[model samples]
Target: MATPKSAVYAASKHAVLGFSNALRMELAPIGIHLTTVNLGPVNTNFFDNADPSGKYRQSVRRYMLDPHKVAQKNCKKPL
Candidate 1:
């Protein structure tokens, strides 16, 4: 989902995924675990700043995830 203006953001996400995968392998033998949650945009005030015009937010509102629900699901899951 790399949009036209989000090259740096996309690259940073990829970098995090790469780093986490490497770290997970390195820590597995010691019983340490890591989890990466790659999710689409959530319904939040972030859109107020990121999309001041409200067009993107309006377009994606129906598809946006509930932040609380997302956190609850992730927190309750076994790592």
Candidate 2:
């Protein structure tokens, strides 16, 4: 759960998780693969686009993940 200020982000992520779970179950019988990769904060231009003011980005800079590292890890062991 996110703080009140980030309720929208939390809700949207939860919705994606729920939908992915349902889709995975539905496709299992059909031998279809459904990989849902839930990535953490990646260091990218997303902050510039999402929060141009940089207020939120600066506040969470320490928590941001490295996009290249994340991609490497995902490639090695995807979910």
Predicted model with the maximum TM-score? 1
Candidate 1: stretches off by over 4 Å: 74-79
Q: Which stretches of candidate 2 lie over 4 Å from their true place?
A: 1-12, 24-36, 76-79
- Spell out the clash pairs found in candidate 2: none
Q: Against the hidden reference, what TM-scores do the models get?
A: 0.69, 0.61
List of clashing residue pairs for candidate 1: none
**Tens-digit lDDT track of model 2 for 1-79:** 5654567888998899899999999999999978887776688997787778888778878988988787777595754
Candidate 1 residue 41 Cα shift, in angstroms, is 0.9
How high is the CA lDDT of each candidate model? Answer: 0.87, 0.81
Q: Could you give me the TM-score of model 1 versus the true structure?
A: 0.69
Per-prediction backbone clash count: 0, 0
Q: What is the lDDT of residue 4 in candidate 2?
A: 41
TM-score, cand. 2 vs. native: 0.61
The top-ranked prediction according to lDDT is 1
